[model samples]
Target: MSDHVMACIDGSGHAMAVCDYAAWISQRLDAPLTFLHVLDNHPPPDEGNLSGNIGLGSREHLLEELAMLDERRAKLAQEQGRVMLEAARERAIGDGIAEPHVRQRNGELVETLSELESETRLLVLGKRGESAHLASEHLGSNLERVARALHRPILMVPETFSAPERVAIAFDGSKTMRKAIETLAASPLFERIACHVVMVGADVADLRSQSDWAVDTLNNAGFEAHGAVRNGDVETTLHDYCREHAIDLLVMGAYGHSRIRRLLVGSTTTAMLRSADIPLLLLR
Candidate 1:
């Protein structure tokens, strides 16, 4: 299986945070590091329709000019991506990575990532992209798409970076979440960090049992771990738990529940991504 850590770099406020977190994870896992940038050069739909409104001779000339302009833009975008990748590479090296790879591709973000998914053990991405200003209330437009398309673990960073000392796992007791706990136990990313396995539901026997199981798994793996059963909404309760515990990072099973359930009761994964200020490590 591939064991490289891939960090997606773009012109966003979260880019620096992404780089730092990726470097941190790479060092912890002792895995190869790669910085990826995708150039989205699809022309606007209206551009093609504009030619019909002009005279034949002028229209042909305008089309030619438009084509040339598109080509220029694509080249510029590639250059910009190259520069960004180079900077990320330097940052990774400064963070103790011996060697970092840089890759630039031209295509849609999700598609490109899906194509390279097999080579990625972990993916680090920003919470927002270049269009952050346009949608401050929402997560990065491509985040959900990419998360759904790839089956690997993903670390989504906010606009700032801080090495985590305390990490909380939002447990739900499903097989999906249980698998996530096992995966976390096998990884070094959260080694030696304080871990809290928090479940939001009635303080029932089953809930406590599941929580204990998760804590035991982590403890066996050498983590400073504990478990808690809270009563409230999943997202709100998890956020409150993190804040109250001064948690630095949140771990969760991304979209672990069924789509029908998510539709009936909004997705906790999406809600957390939209509201949580701390970085999230999503296991799939």
Candidate 2:
């Protein structure tokens, strides 16, 4: 597997937080860091729409001018992406990375990331993107798509970042959660951080056993691990736990539930991404 951390950059409020968090992860894992800015190639709404009829000569002239406009727009977007990538690189260096790589591509963000997934160890991006309203509860349009398409772990940062001191994992003893636990044990990303394994459901003996096993696995791996079972809705309970414990980061499996179930009810992953103030590390 590759060992580089890739931070997605854009002209959003969360860009700086993405850089800082990426740098923090790179330093922790002693991995290379990269800053990526992708210029979306989708044309503007008015690109080829011509209103009203006109003479052939006039129509041809208008078409030429519209082509020129499109070219200019593409060029401007490319330049803007370059500037964003450069700024992200500088921020990463300032955050203690000696050297960070930068790349700008012209394509959809999710497709671009999928093509470069092989070279990525961890993917970091904002929960929201440049086009998203800062005050809106909606997540970045591409956040869930990227998570669903990629197999690598993704660290979704908020609009602000702080070095994580307390980490919580919403464990449910599923295969996905078990994989998350194994990854945490094997990876040095959270070394020595206080870890809480939180499970929400009926307080049954089997659930307690699973939580204990998770806590023990993490504890043996040199983490300050603790286990707790809470009773309530999964998303609300997790949020409350994080707030009450002052958790700096939340870790969990991404979209572990089936699509049908999520559609019928809702997805905890989506809910957390939508509302969590702290950063999230989602494992697939």
Candidate 3:
């Protein structure tokens, strides 16, 4: 992997917010930032199917015109993608990224990201893209697929941007959660930020012990950490805690232990991704 941060943005209301979050991560990691806008290459259906009841002669003429229209639309899409990329690049530069790289590629977003994974260690994008903006229940089409296809860390930025001051780790006593804790503790990403370790479950005593252990693990690594044990299931508990406490960032393992294999096969990660209003830093 190239170790650069890849920020994917379509021309949705979330595009600028994605840029802001990407710029924040790039500056914090001191890594190069690359802005990508994928020109959707999925072709439209044939004119025959589209032109329902037109006569044969008119249909042939319409088919030729439709072909020309397809070409024209493709050209326009490419041009529009370039403009979006240029605007993102300029915004990143203004946000202190010295040389934000910009590229307009043609492909499905997930397929492109999988192909580019070798050079990318971190991927950033808006939680909801252009297509799903109208439906509150629908997730960004590319989010889940990209998360499933690649093992790299993904930062899903919401529609608005905010500088994170308090970061929380949704800790569970699992190997994956342990790895996420160690990684977050060692990285500069959470340095100087208040780290809150929250665990969701009814086993009060066990949960406290686990939270303490995780918090101590982080504190020993030089982070100012606090621990809390919440009562409820993972999704509702963690979400409510973050909201009530004004948490700016939520970090967690993409998948937990086999029983709770969120990203690998479970729906918890997807559920959280759909509802999480703040930025999420997901590790696999």
Candidate 4:
């Protein structure tokens, strides 16, 4: 009901990219943007002299050092969050969007994002931290976990990315896909964006109903969406679509299966996350 876009921010440069994407969305949708910085586990400072501390004064000094470190970390977080939020606010203003309200939280990113859904229209997040690339073989383990834990639509901003011109929604006829489609339809984000609903699987016999339903749903919601059914592996088909169309961003339902199941069948989302050239909007 708040009609605000919530963007997750940290001290990473990719978080700035998230703000850029969120600002684009907020402007297009005419929604306020909220920047959130979650204070997860902090890293410990270097203890170069680990063998020289064994006295009461040493203990006190250590405590003081830790307290100072904590204060510095908190200040750094606040400053980075403010700068990112200001960048987004300025971009939004230039694009004719109203000023956004920025807020911060001290908790796990997943928990804070889920808790803010009541007042958030969409959640935007970066693909990974500053040290890694979105196409890197190693992804942040928490990223997938957060995608699985939340039911809201999450826009994963890739580093050095731009706003989307055309969007593709990965549809596999799953309940989560239906929910994602429904959520996007009822929301204002897709009002001006050109959306293409893609259904990919080995078989196409049963895709008609789902594709028709999706098209009808989008049409009813005032979106001009077209349906396409592809025959091949899910990952291959999706990657091909993105490449062929030069898609700026992709929307897919995050698939969560057992470890064994995932290993055996493979995960489309994981594969794409590992090698995707564009940003992804994931919904669970």
Candidate 5:
């Protein structure tokens, strides 16, 4: 993996938070920082408006005008993307990153990330972006797609920045949770942060054993780790645990027990992302 931390910014309310989070990670891991702003190639699906039936000559003229308009819009979009990227870099520098790299690409978010995914150590992004923020029914489309496409760890920040003191992980004794445990243990991101491992399931189930194993593994890996068992649904229990314990950051595996990309985010994960106010470090 590359030593650079990649932070995606779209000048939305969450962009600043992304920069701050990326700076924190860069400082903690002693890595360089790169800011990326992607300008999608196609127009918004809602923007295609057609005029009433017109003569062939009129239609040709209208099409030409539309092409020109599209060209101008593309130019403006590229310029705006550059400005946004520059501002993001400045913010990252202001947060103590000495010199952050800025890049503007023209493509879908996942496409850009696919090209550069292997070139970054960590990916930092906002929970929502410009167009998708108002839609409460669905999470950020690009965010969901990127999470499904990459195996790298993604740090999803909220609109506001708060330095995390403690991190809680939701463990379900599946391979997904194990991947999170193993990856987090070897990373420096949570070095000084307290680790809280909790499992939510029947009291008599094997959850306790898995929770115990997770705690021991984390402890052995040098984390200030402790495990607890909560009796309730996974999402509700995690939300309450984080709130009551004042966990600053929440970590968990995405789409637990399913490696299929189509399963993207299970109900529990979706609910947690939508309701939890803390930063979520989602592992693939």
Candidate 6:
């Protein structure tokens, strides 16, 4: 699983589409793929409503109802898991991926995703889950929380997509940004795409040397890459740049230091997830 692409599935049509993207990317990167399904625990029964119960018969009846609800939810989660895994398995077989693996976890969605991050090369999640409205870019109820908690790269897939011809990378010269840049440089997924690396900050004058070095690095690897310095709000700048260049994908580090400050102050990554219409590849 360490060398494989890790993806989350919930039996939703959007999740199945994400599986296709994951399979495509895995084949492109020559990596195996693993699918994970998580069962979300529901809230407990309302204690306030218990006061109306008169007899042990009523108490027993309520307990049985609650137990039935739990059993039904569990069955639904498992069914969803099987559907997603089967779809992924079929896609993998078609794409020549051998014996893909699937796992199930009974817990909170965010925690399960976080636990998988360490061994995951890329955590692929749907832009929106089953409960969401169609054509919405809003992250699923759990995706936003998972993105903030998981310290790994996440590729958020839209409902419909073709192979990306061009990509726009939002670089700010931070450590995680550098990590994402290095990962892309080494990965062959960028080989067939035109890459535009945009660094948003006023410190570009000082980073001029490093920027030049990065361009050379990509060029030497046969990548058609370019670097630019832009000054403005990060989300707005990247959005406009992608629109202007007709970029099919947007890649950027998930967040920056003052990381703890994100608890108090909001994060740019979260802002983009809510508002950015394009597919986003987020790195921690």
**Tens-digit lDDT string for candidate 6 (190-235):** 7878998877767556666666666767777788988877778877
Candidate 3 colliding pairs: 1-118, 2-119
Give me candidate 6's TM-score against the actual structure: 0.84
Give TM per candidate: 0.92, 0.92, 0.91, 0.79, 0.89, 0.84
| Candidate that would win on lDDT | 2
RMSD of every candidate to native, in Å, equals 2.3, 2.5, 2.7, 3.9, 2.8, 3.7
Instruction: Give the Å shift of residue 207 in candidate 1.
Output: 0.8
Give the per-residue Cα lDDT of candidate 5 at 249: 95
Off by over 4 Å in 3: 43-60, 256-265
Give per-residue lDDT, candidate 5, residue 152.
75
lDDT of 3 by residue, 230-270 (tens): 77778888888898889999987775446636544257788
- Candidate 5, residue 125: CA error in Å? 1.5
Greater-lDDT candidate between 1 and 2: 2
Error of 4 at 214 (Å): 2.5
Candidate 4: C-alpha lDDT: 0.73
- Pick the winner on TM-score between candidates 3 and 5: 3
Instruction: Judge candidate 5 at residue 75 and give its lDDT.
Output: 86
Task: Look at candidate 5 and tell me the lDDT of residue 58.
Answer: 72
lDDT of 6: 0.75
- Candidate 5 structure lDDT: 0.82
Quickly count the clashes in candidate 6.
Answer: 0
- lDDT of candidate 2 vs native? 0.87
Model 5, residue 84: distance off in Å is 0.9
Rank by lDDT, highest first: 2, 1, 3, 5, 6, 4
How many clashes (backbone N, Cα, C below 3 Å) per candidate? 0, 0, 2, 0, 0, 0
